[model samples]
Target chain A: MTSSPEIAMPAADPKDPYAMPALMPSSADRAIRSFDYADFDIPTRKQEDFRYTPVERVEEFFQPFASSDDVTATVGMIDGSALPDTVTVRTASKEETGVPAVGEPADRIEAIEWAAAPSELVIDIRADTPTPVLVDVSGHGLDLAALHIVIVARPHVRADVVIEHTGSARLAEGVEVTAMQGSELSVTSVQEWNDDSKHVGGHRLRIGAEATLRHSVVTLGGDVVRLRMDQDFDGPHAKSDMLGIYFVGAGKHYEHRTMVVHNHPECMSRVIYKGALSGEHAHSTWVGNALIEPTAPGTDSYELNRNLVLTKGAIADSEPNLEIENGNIVGAGHASSVGRFDEEQLFYMESRGVPERQARKLVVHGFFKELVDQVGIPQIDDRIMATLDARLDESVAAPIAEKADDGTANNNENYAHNQEEN
Target chain B: MSTLEIKDLRASVETKEGRKQILNGVNLTIESNTTHAIMGPNGSGKSTLAYTLAGHPKYQVDGGEVLLDGQNLLEMTPDERARAGLFLAMQYPVEVPGVSMTNFLRTAVTAVQGKAPSIRTWTKELSEAMERLRMDPKFAQRSVNEGFSGGEKKRAEVLQLELLRPKFAILDETDSGLDVDALRIVSEGVNRAKENTGMGIMMVTHYTRILKYIKPDVVHVFAHGQVVETGGPELADVLEEEGYDKYLPEGTTESALA
Candidate 1:
């Protein structure tokens, strides 16, 4: 299968300085067409939403849509290296059938599996089980990649899943997840890719009735990252909480878009997205849309988007849309904001003997703690924190490396380490 | 050198017109293994004195020297002061969302100790501290001060003081908002720390209920940003019985306490 050419359209147009391209449809009734990378579309300054995140840069760095199995293999290879160390590896052959290493969630657990497009992995967690699972995938140079997962919790099961990105430095991936009825699933996805990767991944979750799902995503890497999460509530009385926190550095562009559909009556959904942008040319985009149908009465939904601009040259965009056709629902609302770190909090932390960088780290960590804490699994939580630490290191390290190139490299390492100490 | 010594600490707050004096000219010294009670009516600069010692920016110390033992407390940043064995239990502790009390305490303890304690030791210490304060262990996992009752907040401050083991602590109105039972529990936690360590303490309060549990060796009555009267525990009883009316300036009246 090939992506539609329209997918390649530049998010911004160079020739049209005044006009922006129209946004992709916001309604559920809109057509779903194949996306191709070859046909590039660009947005113009005229568009308020795309004013900050120019898709043109993505077009310049990436090639026009081309069917390259190399890219797919690249992504597949990424999955191989970063697979959860403790996953229940069930190979199709009998030799691979020993208990698929589903380590205890509260303990050390990592899961990663690769299968044919039609294959599925089942993770059955028992009731009241607070296990943590870590999953990893990387498609550094792959073109098209797709992975499917089916998590089955016998009634009243609860567990946490942590997914990490390592080698898949630049590739597109499609992921699918389905949770059975009465299962509580908490999933945390941490993306810490190299600056060279152009990453695109989609996560679709189909939740069963009376099941609870908590999803937290942390994005801190990749040059061009476009991630979309779609959640559908099929069972009545089911609840879902989705949180996303992202930090973008200079010359980096990241986008996180989400669509949640409340299909059943008396269902609930909450989405919180926070981002920080720094550096001279960092860019971030967030588009959130929630659809509440007429039949799904008594549904409660809330969406909030908050952004912090760490530097003047940085850019941030936020778009939140709530479309409710009928008035029978209990409550539905959405809020969005873009701001910088509270100077008061920063000054307070700084005055406390926390050097500037350490204070910044603390504030940023506190910002994301909202989502990170939802992942009930300690193993996943620890890994996510480690990823954040690495990204912060990378952010501070890259500049030092550049300075070192201009001077002495040894001194550069010391300077970088010293800066981190600050 | 005492745990804390303040020399001519003059501080003020900025207003729309100009700077308004908060602490006119105050001087105090507290030795280790002793507790000093600084009691006064509202707005008498009791809290200001605590915040100034902790290096709060709002209260500019126009003239003063705050020394923690021999080191210049004013020269050290708030955190440096903390690491050097200074602690302040605020009258209103700030709510830090998403950061658990356990995580916060662990980091603070490690920072103060210059190394991380073993998880076994740390967790045991945490449980014991919580038990001493009569706090639910679940509170350790909750966001700092988020959704906590008034009494819970006060207890948390004492819990932190126990875990951090600072050489000197300023409990700013720790008894202001607590019920009788809460006050007793908090006082017991503080008393235990006092018994275990040679740390000195400056307790700022308007009420005398807590004094019954944690006896103070000295009492200073603060008025007009200065220690108007320094006496023994008897001063607390007299202030509660007679009120500060007789001490007020000529033009001031009862409502001036506001």
Candidate 2:
């Protein structure tokens, strides 16, 4: 590892067992940011940002290390067509891109990833494309890796981009998106890793004047996945809609944090996230923060988070915070909820001859239909529903499997009978 | 050919106070192609009989049995009972968001029939049923019962009854909130089901106004969780004129009417 003298160092050695604390930030945005590995302290359970995360499971990403070349990335059209002429894709060094970085890292994992990534995979969209651009990243083995991606939408350009993560790896990633003036861009990051994978990612977005951005995060599979998204309106008349969906299974942990900052006047932002948890040890956390500065007058912002707990022993924590320094804003509000399956809905379905398991599936599918429709991509919507169905089946079968072990032959008989009739 | 018998059925519900008994030794029987209207005051357990037969989880069955064509109805789940040719037209249909009315109807039909219906025939049949009920075609695409007016909810219920074609139907206060035109439309749908399927009907209501449209062969006056009197169709007119005053105990207060 190369060490630079210009990097700021902490006052005490973070490795020392008995070192005096240097600094502790009161707010989430006040966390330290640096390029040097030693400047940021190793995250622990005590830190607010890391409290809900399984810090021990992702310790490898917090330390400085060399990233393996096993990770590969490819770009193509969603329809299997060749890349459009209006779009260009190439790998360049961070300095070669010449695009100003949107924001700094907020924590140790992000800082380590920023300093370790060898090059950035940059994709530039000059005009509207016929189909969505697909960036597929796959990890071949269980190895430490780092990825940096920069997406630039030129002035007045319109495009849809999807970043898909699959396979198993302990990786840290940084994705930066810039929507230039008068441009419209939609970016969706889908994390569907293998059962043993661990991932930490940071997404930074900057929206220019008169621009619109629709950002989405869909996390389905992973052992421990944590992502932090920060978006800022750099000019007036910018609008953003941030959406997310996540499903946590047995022994899985998923956390998503979003921070939307309105720094310019007449900017509008909306953030909505929904998640479902099933099976024992399944955990999910969602924290949404919207901040409107005093200078950002006439801003309209709202953030909402909803969670459905499908079974016993699963945990879901939802928190929504809104801060507005300017009372002149059009509206600023926040709402959150964590609840279980509605018994009345289940009963209603059952009364119509739908069995309990199938009834639960229909209700869950309905719960996500609204947000899934907002995704506005048929392929992604179908894929997301298919995965959610499979996971829900597993969740439904788990309790029945236990019931079978307990020798509840009647339930099994009923289930088999229903299956035969179907 | 088919019959539904409720023998000394008793039920109770859990409230803030305690387990309150709602049904006490309620007995009734109806044969195919016959309509029986059960008239009762509020809180007299008329709706309880319908829900208990449908196997709603909130009502606990303390004793007795319900048989549909000689099969024990209480032993089955709600879905199983539905598949066994028993239908309940709820007074207040539930609102299920994001589940389109067409999709819900198709699923229910599939579950009850043990197989899926042909898409071509199903679509035509649904459109025809809605047209007969004076319902807009766009309702098929809307969520089930969501944002529907009272009249619309009742019409949707009757639409299901006609489509499912069950052998026995328990209409729990189906005419409570309908206007004159909506009442006639809904009654026409029920009469069509009877003519097409020969289904037996147990229509529960508080007022006899609906008896004019869906004529009943027998009328049962219910009070204090028990059926006190049974007579012919003319009994409805007697109760409609004099009210349920004679059915109550001597010197019973008006507050007990509900």
Candidate 3:
């Protein structure tokens, strides 16, 4: 095996990627620059990649090249845990750990985020952290915001990091994570924003030989939210798991698009995401794409997406795409489904003396618990579960007819009317 | 003591064919301290009485009134019935994915008892209960009934019945999925609950095999959506010697009674 330095760019695919981002200017690419529209092109639904996305709404919410000067952020240990405090956090410019040394942008929104953030925040972990490091990024009254974060886990070490976005702003950020050889890392991104907030981000995870990475996202807030997760193997025998849980509410949109590129041989990846939607016109979408290159002969990959629609007038879109150039691969498969509450499951719980509202809450919580447990970090897992519980209680913990009584839902009559179908 | 009385109960279930009546003008009563064994062949609507009394939404109450201690049970939700001291050990328990047994048990106990059991006592009780049922300690950590064998699920139902401590429990063919050893272990648990709390039991079974373990105080023979005969425990032996064929009308075939 050649001890080669990391390559930021992947071998361009002829037909697999489907859509590519226009690169930044050579000067801006060399050094992080202020907002620049030259690096991004207007996306239209005519493009297959952009068809499911509400491109026009995203374009109008916040334009590229705008800085978040008024916003503030704070990074600290979670819940005052008595964990090791050796993690080093810093803020710097392009020269820091060779900016853009990680994976490249896979879409136009990512390119815009790269050019908009004023500076980069770099976090270096020399060993496994006893406590999780949290970064709370929030915005005040503002039209747009941008930030950049880089996390590096040294060889044979482990690290856990959580980034929480809150308050109001049209926010865009790019996160770069690199796990060196034999290292393990987990990064959780939670979007708990105000009703007026909107966010877009591209997170790139690169792993060295035999390294492992767990990347999870919990999206529960914001009016319009979209995140792109891109994974690439820098060396052979690397494994990664991408997991997420999202709850979409009324007149809001939350979409997650992912691409896992097996550029090295003997690598494996698994992706599982579950979501629930409530309210009128609330929408959620999951798009998973796994591409296996011909040289990656021992590649094994699978992805699954499932959605539960709680009330009427909600939409859930699930698509799993697999593009493999090598027929010699170990295995490859994908599956997705969007469904309503299971009548049998509900009846089973109700028969046990759990109220209908409480039964729905329990069922929804049960649906997400399997994936939440895989988060691998106890404190973070509990925190996500707490957030999920709060969301469930707020929306699904009551009878639909009661929600209609408050005039919060329009077609809640469908909830009890479906009794005939069940 | 609590008494459960079902009077003139009539119910129908919707199928592809149409809404078919499953329970027709049935009547029965059980004091909290007594046990009743419901013996009926398949399609005799024995299980229907258990589910309808427990408030399954699929079973429309065309006409009926179920009173628990003189309070109308039909007016309450399933959970309310449970809180009011009623439980059902289903023939086939539904598997709830992602919900641990410990969590479900705690929630159910808290809801039924109107308070949470202390952690120390709760842990000790659950562990001891699992041991009595010959279940591995790790089974408590598993998702509720998910991927469990039939015997394991049956044991889980009994486990819940014991912990919840309701006034009455409707065991709908609880013996169907058990081997001899499991049947003995489960029946002993039920007997312990009854002896300790005087929890009335309506044990519904097609065969008299389970009756050998837990003796029934009263036995009722059901046919064609109604009870045709009521007798003491000796009736179980009579039916054991003579199959349900005698209960059918002279001209009618026993195929529907299957």
Report the number of the highest-lDDT candidate.
2
Better model by TM-score, 1 or 3?
A: 3
* Segments in model 2 whose C-alpha atoms lie over 4 Å from true places: A1-33, A36-39, A400-422, B249-258
C-alpha lDDT of candidate 2 relative to the true structure: 0.86
Q: Write the per-residue lDDT of candidate 1 for residues B1-258, one digit (tens) a residue.
A: 356789999999989989999998888999999889998877788898998888876778789888776798888767788888888888777776666778777777777788889999899989988987889999998887889999999899888888878788889988877888998999989988887887899999877777888888899988889999999988778777777776677766442121
DockQ of each two-chain model: 0.21, 0.62, 0.55
lDDT of 2 by residue, A123-220 (tens): 99999875999999897877889999999899999999999999987779999999999999999999999998988978999999999999999999
Clashing pairs in 2: B42-B258
Task: Pick the TM-score winner.
Answer: 2
Clashing pairs in 3: A35-A65, A353-B79
lDDT by residue for model 1 (A53-80), tens: 4556543223323223333221111223
Task: Name the best candidate (by DockQ).
Answer: 2
Ten residues in a row with the worst lDDT in model 2 chain A?
A: A413-422
lDDT of 1 at A367: 73
Instruction: Give the alpha-carbon lDDT of every model.
Output: 0.68, 0.86, 0.81
- DockQ, candidate 2, vs. native dimer: 0.62
